[model samples]
Target: SAKHSDLCERRNIYADEKSSLESELDKNLVQRKNELEMTLIDARIMESETLVENESFDLELIDKRIASFRQLLEEKDAKIDELVKQQTDQKELLDKLRAAEDKQMDIINVEAKTSRKIAIKLETIEKKHNECLRKLSKMGTIPSDCDNNYHNMSLKDEYLELQKCKHKLSKMPSVNQKALDQLTEGREKGRILQLEKREIKAGYESIQRLIETLEHQKYEKIQVTYKSVSKFFVEIFQRLVPEGKAFIDMVYKDSADSGSAGSQASGSHASQESQSSGGISGAGLTPTFAQIDNFIGVRIRVAFTGKTVVKEMNQLSGGQKSIVALAFIFAIQRCDPPPFYLFDEVDQALDPFYRKALADLIKEMSRSSQFISTTFRPELLGSAQKFFGVKFAKRVMILENICVKLISDCNMN
Candidate 1:
């Protein structure tokens, strides 16, 4: 009951204080409203002052955060400095490493060379050891009695025997290691050469046969042409010269060597040829064209009735030689007739009778061949189917007046 009274007394005291505080707060609120009327932003100024205080506190916090960030930046800068130093150290180390590698390579090369020399020396020693073992093996086991006998020999005698054996061994010839291989290679080369020789021989034989065949054909052509020319020459010469003997002789080196013997034979044959037709030394040329290369020439042998021996072309008169020339030309034409014959003043050296004979021959051949002759002789004019005359009216010689046959037909087409 006392504690309850104490609580009520305390509540009455708190109520009185609250009432006084409420009245005081109302009075303050009215004063603040009046102050706001007097200075419209006074409360805002007060709130701004508090806000400025809170902002100052926030600035302190930002300053602390800035200080922390600066420490962090300084730490990162130090780390960058440390990393740059490490990179510099690594670069220097890499240079040292490369230098060391080059030095090591030089050392390794030297060692490799030394090892190779040692290996070669070792191989030589091993070969010598193997050779000694092989020789000892070949010697086999010595008999006990022989061993005893060797043991009894003096040291000087054994040394002398060793020297003698060494001298004999030095005299032994060295074996050729490649003899079998060389022999095989030589045999193979020999076989290949033999095959090449056979092929060459076969090619040579084939070429030789081909040359022979060509030579035979060339000989046939020469003989056929010579036979026809010679036959016509005899008959034509008889017509041109009533009592003259003429023959075309192939002057081979062999016939020239026979001299007068060949001349006498050819002379007798020409005499008989006037009756019939045959010329001595009329055989075909040598089958080999190479022999034709050895040939001298064709000689014209003519014998007038007054002359006993056949005369060469050089012995005839100008007119007689001209006649023989005409005969020769006619003979060749009869044998292998050409499409045209061009005679430039051939009748100029001929006698009137010979010229007349030549004109007749031309007229006869005119049926098959065209003859263009330049001659002052009327005999050639008589045989002409067409004629062109030169007029010297101007300084230049102009061809004018086409005359077919006679001069009377100068305007003839």
Candidate 2:
């Protein structure tokens, strides 16, 4: 029984050891399960964070695209505004063109009416001139006959008066003293009648010369009047264009091809002189229609040295034409001087040296006339006695900067 009890105790000890080993195994298993569960929860949290990150990145991209689209819309709106402005400008230009066309048409109609009126007036003048010529011819013929008849009658009357004086002397001879007195009276009467006849002859000759002189003077006056008008045009044309030649042609009635034919005839005599001296004195004379028989026509020629040959006024460059036109206007002003002159952009085409020369010329001219010019160049400003600059938001300001610089320089000196 003691051996059985010892065996039982050993058995109990082994069973207890086994039970503790099982409990430790179960605890390790529980711990491992709890660790797996915690790892799974951590993995889920990481997946959720990654998803949130992707969503935020997508939202940022969408915001950028919207901003780009808004910029494109603004650009398109700006282009539309520019196009609208161009369309409005084109409409205004079209309106102006239509108005100009209408004005040109009105000018054409007025010119046509004026031409018709001039034609009618010319016809009337021609008719009146012909009637006057007819009347003059008739008067000339009648006056010549009347003068001859008057001369014959004066001679007959003188002869009758001499015979009457002789008869009176014979009757007075009965009284010797009376006869002598009568003879002396008759001699004195004869001398007086001779003197009267001589005076009458002289009066007739003087009257004829006076008529001839009056007709010659009338012809000369007409020629001079026409010449004066032509000279005026020539002077005007000369002033209008620098280094240009101009002339006027006078008209006459007697010849059909008078201008060319007469010029050729005069040229034959004029060829002895140089062409630079111009044509013969009378070579320019030409006959035209009755109305404009005394009228004068003008011709002008301009020579440009450099660049392409410009045959017409329109062919010249803007600056060149302006200069030429200004020269002409200045020449006109010289004919009738003005109180002063104002010039703007007048030296646009001139170079520095030429500009200086022009300023000097202006200064020289200013002795007789006052001149004012506006310019942006420093060289041009130097020409002025007093310089004023137009400043933004400020009234005409005298250029004090230059003066300040000059004073500083003087102080340094």
Best prediction by lDDT: 1
Query: Model 2: residues >4 Å from true position, as ranges?
Result: 1-300, 306-310, 351-354, 378-382, 394-413
Worst 10 residues of 2 by lDDT: 272-281
Which pairs clash in model 2? 239-328
Per-residue lDDT, model 1, residue 294, is 54
Clash number for every model?
A: 0, 1
lDDT of each: 0.77, 0.60
Candidate 2 lDDT tens digits, 1-413: 99999999999999999999889878997788889899989989998999999999999999999999999999999999999999999999999999999999999999999999999999999999999888555433233465565575667785686578568867875545344446768999999999999999999999999977886676676555445544543344344333344333343343333655565455334332312334112344433233353444422223443232323345566755654465456545665679888988677876565456556656656788777777644445545555444555456544432454543444345
Task: Give the per-residue lDDT digits (tens) of candidate 1, residues 1-413.
Answer: 99999999999999999999889878998788788786867777888999999999999999999999999999999999999999999999999999999999999999999999999999999999999888765544434586776788999998797688668756864845346657778999999999999999999999999988987787778767776777788777767666777777666787678776666665565555533445433432233566665567677787656356677888888888988998989998887789998888887777887888778878987899888888876767767777888778758888875645456443232
Please give the RMSD to the true structure for each candidate, in Å: 22.4, 40.4
The reply for model 1, stretches above 4 Å from the true place, is 1-173, 257-266, 273-275, 278-294, 304-309, 402-413
For each candidate in turn, the TM-score is 0.51, 0.29
